[model samples]
Target: MHEMTIVAGVLEIAHRQAAGAGATRINRVVLEVGRLAGVEADALRFCFDVARSGLSAIAELEIRDVPGRGLCPACGASRDVDELAALCEACGNVLDISGGRELRVLSLNVD
Candidate 1:
């Protein structure tokens, strides 16, 4: 799965950051994953468990779920959305996605 690639990148960043800060181990990693990012959190966690070694072998992962948001141009309103091509509930027009496409590391606890 692509989640393995994502996990590999995350771990690489974690290792680099920890080493840059003169830390030998990573204690925790916090990630903010948006609903519209199209990546499964469970798969990421599983991949992390399988791929992590060395400095991050015992690191804990914390994933924060972010809800998708959209703006309706026809209605001039913003609302929560579940998918990318969601229709506006108020005016039946297509919504322009405003948020919830993020997949990034928010923080890392290292020492």
Candidate 2:
């Protein structure tokens, strides 16, 4: 599955970062995944567990789900957005998505 590829990329990044910092292992990893990032949380978690099996450095994976958000230039209103329909709640206008499309590493605890 694509989750395996995603997990492999994450492991590679974590390993590189840990090695660069002279850390023998990773204690934890915190990830920020947005609602519109198209990633399934359960799949990612399972893949991460499988990928980190031999890597002693990665002990834990923490995922933070971020809500999709949008901003309306017509009414200067900004609020949480629905991924399917980005509409401004204040004015019922089409809004520009401003957030909640991220898939990135937030932090890591290495030692």
Candidate 3:
């Protein structure tokens, strides 16, 4: 799955950052994943465990799911959205994406 690749990238970034900071071990990884990012949280967790097993430093992974939001460009209004293509409630226009497209490593707890 693509989550494997995503976890690999995250591991790479974590290693780089930890090494730069002179950290001998990684204790935790905090990730902020948006609902619209198209990533399966369970798959990510599984892949992270498998991927980080070789590293010994990474101990835990925490995922934070963010809800989607949309903005109406015509009416300057914003609201929670469940789908990618949603019509604005204020105006009939197609809503622009305001949030919930994130796939980021929020923080790392290391030693």
Q: How many backbone clashes does candidate 1 have?
A: 0
Model 1, span 1-111: residue lDDT tens:
999999999999999999999998999999999999999999999999998899998999999999999999898889889999999888999999988999999999998
Model 2 agreement with the true structure over 53-72: per-residue lDDT tens digits: 44443578899999998889
Q: Sort by lDDT, best first: what order? A: 1, 3, 2
| Candidate 3 segments whose C-alpha is farther than 4 A from its true place | 54-58
State which candidate, 2 or 3, has the greater lDDT: 3
Misplaced by over 4 Å in model 2 are 53-58
Which scores better on TM-score, 1 or 2? Answer: 1
Task: Write down the lDDT of every candidate, Cα atoms only.
Answer: 0.93, 0.83, 0.88
Model 3, residue 96: distance off in Å is 0.4
How does residue 12 of candidate 3 score in lDDT? 90
- Candidate of highest lDDT: 1
Clashing residue pairs, backbone N/CA/C < 3 A, model 3: none
- Which candidate do you rate higher for lDDT, 1 or 3? 1
RMSD, each candidate, Å? 0.9, 1.7, 1.3
Better of 1 and 3 by TM-score: 1
